[model samples]
Target: MQRWLTYQKERFPLLAHFPLVLLTSWCVLSFASPEPVKIGTLLLVTLLILGLFFQLRVFDEFKDYEEDKTYRPYRAVPRGLITLRELRNVGLFVAGFQLTATYSWNYPSLTLLLVCWIYMVLMGKEFFNPEWLKKQPLLYMLSHLPIVALIQMYAASFVWDLDFPPATWVLALVSLSGGALLEYGRKIRPPEKEEHGVQTYSALWGIPRALMTWFLAGSFGVFALGFAGGGWWVLSVFYGLMFPYALISALRKSALWLKFVELFSAIWIVLMYLALARFP
Candidate 1:
């Protein structure tokens, strides 16, 4: 139990993820339907989103096992803090629970849920072309990032009829941009912190270029949120503040600021969704 707790702390901090997922699930449902979201339904959808995220984390653990063992031996699995078999069982259990719950709650959602699972499985296998994909970091990131949008679509299934009109898809676009922003934010490390085999945007594209990409992603997110009826002033201000901080941090090569950038990415997503929920 203690080991599992430590693993969750290191790999997936619940305190940070729960509210973000909850808000994400809520905003999707709220955006889909004008009616007030029921508490029970909101909680169920949040559970589903949380399970999907954890399942993906487990998939990453399995897929990256070798590289992690060789280049990142201090991680939970390589350090022997947890076994792959144990993580596999947990993943299976979560998958089963998600499948069962979705089937019981809304049979129509099951199809979309299965589709999301298929995409996730493909991601876990790196689309069976790990060599080619690894050589193309941009494509690799784009392929995996759509899962965030798919998860949002699945959440919308609870409130929407699944027709997924243009307006509905704009919400997915917001999610995709958020995923990109978070992906770039977390991977933009200082030069001193770059690992030999680890692939970071900073290492691949250099700091200035990586920061530009991150900024563009955040810009797209703001546009999508505005299109989806989100409040813009607050989001714009927050983005303006974070960009300079990111520049200063990258310039000084401050590891602490890089961590802040990651945390700010989460905050940005949460704020975007919150803005949608409020203005809707």
Candidate 2:
């Protein structure tokens, strides 16, 4: 058990928790709002989704084993912390549990089951065939948008049973742009080290160009989210605050700054929801 715990920590990392937190919070918030829905089943469904999410990480660790050896040596798979067979078993178990859990919830859970399965499939493709979608920086950046948007969409649908508002579409676009910018920023890291095995957007586009793309993408995201909530002036200002920090991170050549950008980006969605809750 201790060894398994260590493997999970090394392979999945805390970064994996962010999506679960965001999705669960959105689900709860949607339920609390003007059009409340039954959440008793939703909570259990979310737990199953999160469990599947972790299991998929194990699959990802195995799938990216080769690439990780070259570029991410610290990753658990290559470090010999876990075995491929173990990951396979875990993945199968999680998949089965996810399906069973969703089926128990009702039609809404069924829809979520399909969406989650697609996300897992995409992750496999992204990790294995970087050549297929990941090779194209723009397309790679766009890849995550659907998954993020689907989180909110699932929550809105489950809670309100209403078609997702236009604002949700705007939020999805914002997520897409931010994802693109971050990928673009990473592409330029240590520009001289292009010989490294990993092919990145910055490697293809160069630093200056990547920075331009990142800035434009970030700018559009802020504006998109800002207006999405109907100009709750304070939240709009908060959204704009992310740009300066991203710029500083650019100037200093620091990936840590990118973490800040991600944090702020996530907070924008939460704030947008809160700002909207003030009305109706």
Candidate 3:
């Protein structure tokens, strides 16, 4: 048992936990507001989503095996801590099991599960195709937007059964811009001399240029969130909280953007919950 726990920790890492926490909380909050659903049903959805979530990590290890060896040797697959066969087996088992459990939920729940699966597959492709899409930076960012929107939509409407409120849109936009910040930060990786396979933003374009593009994209995110209609103070507080992170990012010291955005994203979610409580 101890060995299995350690393996999962190595395979998924702490960063993996953030997405699961955000997603699961979104689902549970859905159950909480407007009207509460049966605890049993909510529990089932949580378990299923969380299960698939972990399994997706396993698949990432399998897909990025070589890249991990060269660039991210600490990662589970390249480090030889876990085998490709084991990853595939575990991913399939978890996905099948999670879907089977979620099948008992309403049709919308099952559909949401299916949508999540398709997203996992597509995201894997996106990571591999980053270079191909870099020609159109805006299009590249636009392509990734739906993934965030889907998560927000599932949490806001499908699970919560709440109307698409201004607050939910704020959350979705925050999630998108937060993610873009990561893409922007990737532009800062020191340039490599030799030809490389890694299709990162920095790899395709030199760090300075990438950072400029990313900052512009982030500016758009801030503007969108700022203009989005909602409670003035709540929105102000949310955007204000993000500014420090952006400020730190502008200093161009290191990859602090992710740290800031992660903090910002978490705070954004909390603000959303507060808005939900006060407004609805």
lDDT of 3 at 148: 54
Over the stretch 240-267, how does candidate 3's per-residue lDDT look in tens digits?
6555545455455355443343445455
RMSD of each: 1.7, 4.3, 5.0
lDDT of 3: 0.56
lDDT of 1 by residue, 71-104 (tens): 9999999999999999999989998999999989
TM-score of each: 0.94, 0.72, 0.67
Q: List the lowest-lDDT window of 10 residues for candidate 3.
A: 186-195
Candidate 1 C-alpha error for residue 259, in Å: 2.9
Candidate 2 yields a Cα-based lDDT of 0.58
Q: Residue 192 in candidate 1 has what lDDT?
A: 79
Q: TM-score rank, highest first?
A: 1, 2, 3
Q: Which scores greater on lDDT, model 1 or model 3?
A: 1
lDDT by residue for model 2 over 40-101, one digit each (tens)? 64566456546655766665676678888888777667777777888888888877876776
> Which pairs clash inside model 2?
187-202
The models' CA-based lDDT, in order, is 0.85, 0.58, 0.56
